[model samples]
Target: MLPAIIASSRIVFADDALDIVQGDRIQAEIDALRMEIDDLRDERDEASLDATRRTEIRRLITDVVADAEMRTNRIDRPWNVIASADGDFTLEADVIMQYDWVLNSTSSEPTRYGFSLDTLWLSLGGTMFGPKWSYGVCAAVGSDGTFIPEYAYVQHQFEDGLFVQAGILSEYFSIEQAINPNEQLGTSLSFVAGQFDAGQPEGILVGRQFDQWRFWSTLSNGWGQSYIDPLENQRTGVMTRVELKPFGDWNTLYMFNPYPGLVDRGLLFGFGGSFDWGDYAAGTGRSISGDATRATADVSWQQDGVGLMAAAYYQDVPVSQTDGGRRWAAVAQGAFFPVSTWDVYARGEWGAVENGSRSDFAMATIGTSWIPAGDSRLKVVFELVRSWGSTADWSVDGDIGILSTDGDQTVFRTQLQFAF
Candidate 1:
């Protein structure tokens, strides 16, 4: 019976041992062995065994049980978090697919309602020497199905509270720019933050966390700011961001907070400023030198399930080798969580060029984010936008071409996001 059982389980035993086996069938084999021992040691002595033989059976059974228990107790990590047991290296990956439908009456173009591929991308990370050192990479599909590299960088950590990253990185100049789309409450970002501030340059950034103070600074090639090959990136761009968490736990200070529970009830104050001289470089454009600078201040607070945030920014960008006027933008955003996984939010955003000398555009938006399974990685968001006032130079803000030709418009957007 013992040989038959081992044969059926495909378990090969050591020369001096019974067998080595693990996995779900282990417990069954253990139970059967125990029953055999009980029968062998019956008080009636009909099937009694010698003490030496009985001890050997118990020992082998113990080894099998221990191996089974060890295997069963091992942690099962998610598919995205790949790591080695020795803490030497790890990797993680995620895929994001998004679709956008913008229904609006356009003053510059015809009324439009259609489905567009907003974003289809991949996020991947590799850590060579543990969490203290890693690299991040992202790529997105373009309208023509071409692959565009969004981020590629290396991050290193130091013991004295300093960390550094070098790569093609996004500007740390605005609240909206600091977070990814899925981490944001609205489908569309504030016009100003999306347009004038959405520059991803190849550079290096350093950051530190001390008590409640978090500081970050960057010096980079300002990749998208130049059109000239090697000569276009001659100028270095500088940026700095500082934040203070007066009441929250330091660990939560950098969390992608889509809701209030992401951190303890508290307040945060932040500022970001940057200055660079280079052409907005990319594709097949001529590299023309120009000045680009931005400054912003923001405050955020959350208590219970309610949260509020406000930010203001000023930007001066050069175009056509001419000094363009400064652009200003602001937003007052708030959210309420009737239920922990559901939130209702509203935001009022406005932007203008150089003290409103040109023209101004103000947008009001109402939106909600729902996490059906209480998973932060999977989120569904919907937003309604109404814009009034007027915009003369759509380039005054950073909204990619969504607000290209603008006047008064209404927009409806919904997005479903998932990670891992």
Candidate 2:
């Protein structure tokens, strides 16, 4: 009936010819359906023109199989998809939110609101079998709300400049509290730069690089600080660091180039100081804790876009009986960046407990930060604090009494952050 509908048409069409059906109008509609099947074989009328040419060739193959199943269901549906391959391994995630506003100028009710979940963070870093061993794991959501583990690490490279690291990481202390946690301007921890409450211990660290000098060392356990405890005792501690650049170009000052469009002048100087003497006992011994000493000293500088840092700390407590007491603390900080997302900061601290009757402390803070779009993952900060001791108790003015009746207490804070 038109060559039996093109020999029982099974539709295997892909040699590309019918550019949308105009090959001389499909050969003049198959030559007018073979002259109407030879005029119905000369008058029997070939069963009504073979049922109207097999219903117009089954409606043109059901409209070309419904437009190829609507473009294969819009490319196998999956909201905004992206997958990778070619040396594999790629994963990422980050979600963080924070808000804090506290003002209590002697509480005639100034303002107070604090919300945190500051980081729901989960990141499983990559690069393996190729970049001389690189690995990472950063987890979050803790402060007792569970899911701890922050930064499980591995980094190894050996030859000349040497390198090594093993398990649970991050302890090189205060490079803006260990490398910018969203550009921290403040939201706690200035009782003299000392809160990262540990966590991530089970260690080994070694580093070396010569020419513009660099060095490193570490040993751990010393009572796991955070992440809700990780075997709290069996005291151990050690740390050492040294760095110097003095302009001999370590890849233009340790590689982080930017300037074509501005922002990134070079200069870096360094030193990191640490010490921890140990043997501690306090599970409720009433009064008797052995040898505990802490030490710190730091200096930093950055050029062009401007950045400067400073640090100091000292702690020694050896009170086993009435007349044997000692305690000490100190802190200092500074920051500036007239643009490149803006920033300004200041800090000061002091502490004491010699001959204890609890009344030695001092604090000061000043801050500002605005990231607008320079995207340190979005940030905004404002801080002003002035605390005066009685051995300052925790936070929120040590939960009221304004540090023993307003001898000195002033606070104003603002924070808004989002990281993802």
Which candidate number has the best lDDT?
1
Clashes of each: 13, 3
Ten contiguous residues with the weakest lDDT in model 1 = 15-24
Residue-wise lDDT of candidate 2 within 1-420, one digit each (tens)? 888777556343432345556777889999999999888787766677878889998998998877666555345434332223333333344556555656656444344444444445555665566555667777677657777776687877776668788777766643434453554445544554442233455577788888767777767654233332334444566665566665534443331212122334444455555444543344745323355455565555445544445555544545553322455556666556666677677878776666666677677888877776765567787788877755332222112112333256787777777766
> Which whole-number lDDT from 0 to 100 does residue 6 have in model 1?
82
Q: Summing lDDT over every window of 10 consecutive residues in candidate 2, give the lowest-scoring window.
A: 393-402
What is the Å distance of residue 48 in model 2 from its true position?
A: 37
Candidate 1 lDDT, tens digit per residue, 120-187?
A: 77888878876789898988888898877777889999999799998777567666677665555556
Question: Each candidate: RMSD to true structure?
Answer: 17.5, 24.5
